[model samples]
Target: MSRIVLRHQEKRMIWSASSNYNLQPFKIELEQNVPRMLQQVKETDLLGTFHLAGPDAGITLEQLQSLRSQWLSDFDWNKDQAILNKFHHFTAKIETLAIHFIHEKSDRPDAIPLILNHGWPGSFLEFVPVINDLTQAAKASTGQDVSFDVVVPSLPGFAFSSAPPLNWTIDDTARIFNTLMTKVLGYSEYAVHGTDWGSGVAYSLYDNFNTSVRATHLTMAPFLPATPVQLAEMNITLSAEEQFEEDEAMNWNAQGNGYFIEQTTKPNTLGLALYDNPVGSDPRAGTPPSVIDHNEILKEVSLYVLTKSFLTSIYIYWQNPNGFKSSYTKAHTDAPLLFSAFKYNIAFWPAALLQKVGNLVYYRNHDFGGHFAGLDNPPALISDLREIVVYWK
Candidate 1:
């Protein structure tokens, strides 16, 4: 009801100005709303969402046609909604904002408490791949502490979460989420894993609350393009794989920068057009620079459509240029940090540079997968996350 009531107020305060986080079970009436939204999609001017021709097109006339056909004939809202209900969902009001999250605890005492955050064009859904793996490992670990009690949140302004306030930044986000983990969940100390926009929040959590925020893991980091002068001075060496990844990241900046520029400068313009159509948000919204399979892409689009959270999802770009800032130049913590770079990711920073930011303990390079490693290469992300256990305790 709250989500429906707060339609598209870019600058309006959507929640009560209080910290009354009365946890409520999340339930959506997809049966009642899906048909109406689908009708809007049928009447949508999708031709505008696309502009390119030939090989490099945005969503494409063909992709748009395919999405409509799949929505009408193949998509199953009931089955998909049932799958979502399988997980534990909860929402609470925090700092005049409503926060939605998944809190699933492992039965085993050996499990450690962990929080996972998602990025823009993305929601809490990105972390679904590793949910059962992390939560169920507690049962399989038998004699050891291998699994985790996972807490994954829909970052404010995305999915079931509320659109952030007018001046809300990622650091503001970090503060509220820290409250969620420590004050709401009653966790004394915890570890965090993040990707895309999430990596910024994860880093902020590690920086602001070193005591409760124990260890940090990221698939992306603070990476900048290596200039010729800097490369020569540092004697930068890249393996063949690293060289390919560097080229891919640079190419993405050239080709994919439009989405970034529009969302950051004029998010409301696009958000308004897509407000009625849930396909307004697509699986591609959450993905990195890779060709996602049709089925995988459809599943993500369906979730946002059914939940009616797509419009608010794009608000992240407008809410915070930097998520939860923490730049005490003289301050540094020995909190163990672990990072992994997928071959096709948008950016990759050298380990030496990562050390300048925080305590660097583990780093690795994957031969396969891209930016959405959690979805594209779950096994590798799982193994990489498990790698953190070595230094966690």
Candidate 2:
């Protein structure tokens, strides 16, 4: 049986020959790779519950031990793998890297082209439910056959996308995605939605190539002004939601920033370690796991292990240590901007932030959902997106 291969060389050509990027393609070869039960917990010293805030902020040494035991003994990997592969997957070479993405096309004639970007600790899987629900809505609402020709690309160094050979920043990523939309997919104008790191990419597109992007939506807004007049003009009022976001950002900065620091400074070292033992230990070792909540260790490991896409994902952080900083300095876009603030996200201040940024034609502070809104509440997310697109249209 011949195996399917996605091309990457063509995309890499867009970069100048002087660019120092390098990529190597490798296939996963498994022999009797099946999920097995984790070993029983042996570390008894670390057992008990740990809290992210309030009086019970830190976990006892014993709780860490117990958490490790449970993580090692429980959690199924094979189940996770089956769930991840449900969507149609394909890869394209962008420059010197292989880019993996999920393309779900709606049969509707007037389907709008939209690119959805996911952030760190998130794969293309994050947008699956949103895509499914929105596509269905398009079929029902606009009998005119309105649908979204969706493209969910794995960020370079995550999932199926190839890693960068040298340090590439968010601008580099935006350029590559722009090519993907204009050259590879052949879309003249498209809508873009992004969350977390994705928001940075979406903002870049709007700033650099506003003509190509019809509209842009972001789940996280990280821009802030240096003056008060700019804030007042933007109608920057601190609602309860906005206050909460500020508080959370402060808290995370104080107690839960080790991961970010590590990723920004020594991503390569950590990436190699994670690649070797994607599911070896509890990812919640030093801090309270809830604060930095992620899927179980087994699930995270499964994502990297089965796909062998660990290095690819890590390379994004490794190459673009200053990506976030660079994104902050980029000019604001005059295009229509939509901001969605999840209830539990403390780092978001929708009303005030949007007012200060630019023309926030649409803004919603969702009463539910969190950082991973698409995954946590797909139905609400889909409805919000549909309504916003309709209003803009």
Candidate 3:
């Protein structure tokens, strides 16, 4: 296969050609001379689980087997590549990096400029399901039709974007993203939404670039939930439902955060270990197949596997060890803030706690959806996006 290779000389020339930002159309093409990734999936030796069954014991052996079987027999990267190409993809040279993003604009003249951000174990691919709907106009409470000129970018060191320096953190990402929207794409002001680490970037944008980031919406907060001691000191109370949510969050911290500690302390080791193994690269196998379609999950896994981004994607965790644990004092923003809480999401922060963080304008709780709200519940996610715009604008 003939690849669209940007040689070292060409890259240097392109970099030195202009100080101004340049946005160019880009596409993902299958690379040549690559080893058969599926063959490695076929060879992975899944370990037996402990006494607990299902996700409690980690990604079940059965789940791994099913995913491996599908990859080896049914998954087609070329077909998926065609689907991805249907969207408008672009790369913008900003600062010292080239950022890859999906820039889908609506035909309507007044469509809102909205930027969606994704987090670890997820990519811009998370928003692929709702891109078209978001572009279509919807009636806001103010009786105006609202649509989005949506932009979803692959964070630095993830997907096709250039890698970040060892000391880089989410703050740097926020600065560059602000430049990407205002400086590169020329959006004077835009609304922002994010989940996971993307929420950190979104919050930073709202906090640091309030003039440029008009409003902010997030599926989760960037800061860690208040500790039990802090909650007691503050005399805050959780309802039964809230307590249940907190318990679930505690369980997740206990069980699901091993990857967090590892990635924070020694990202290089874990990154190198899973770099070439698709099965190992995929950590979502344990999520019940019902929460998100296997095909959708496979799409992300495939992107990480094929693009060779598995190593870089986990760098955020290491780069910002305190990213999620930082105090909420610095999170306050002048921009209106909106939050959508899905019942099945990994963590929960009460409205009382959130008020200290920003100008909380809208907060909704959905009975459906989970961590990957974009994939788990696009309709609810889309509705929330439309509804929140009404409050912020």
Compared with the true structure, all predictions reach lDDT values of 0.70, 0.60, 0.78
**Residue ranges of candidate 2 with Cα displaced over 4 Å:** 1-76, 138-146, 222-236, 274-297, 308-312, 325-333, 391-393
- Maximum-lDDT candidate: 3
TM-score of each: 0.83, 0.72, 0.87
- lDDT over C-alpha atoms for residue 34 of model 2: 36
Indicate the TM-score of model 1.
0.83
Model 2 residue 249 lDDT score? 56
TM-score winner among the candidates? 3
TM-score of model 2 (CA atoms): 0.72
Compute the lDDT of residue 244 as modeled in candidate 1. Answer: 77
Candidate 3 per-residue C-alpha lDDT over 1-393 given as tens digits, one digit per residue, 9 for 90 to 100: 111132233235434442476778898886441246776777776664443477665676676668767777887777878889999998988889999999898876566778999998889988888899999988866776788889999999988898989899999999999888776666666899999999999999988998878888999999897766677788889877677667767777777777878989998888876622222121343343323656666778877877788888888898898998557774545678889987767778877788889988788886666788887778878888887567544
lDDT of 2 by residue, 1-393 (tens): 111111133224424321333322233223234332232234333324543344234444544444565455655555555665666666667787677777666655456678898876667766866776565535323333345778888888776676676667777888888877776665666788887778878878877887778788887754532233444575665766556656665565566556657777776666664421211112332232122233443455555655566656666665656555412343455677777776655255545456555567777776556666666556656655664455334
**Model 3 spans > 4 angstroms off:** 1-19, 31-35, 47-55, 275-291, 330-332
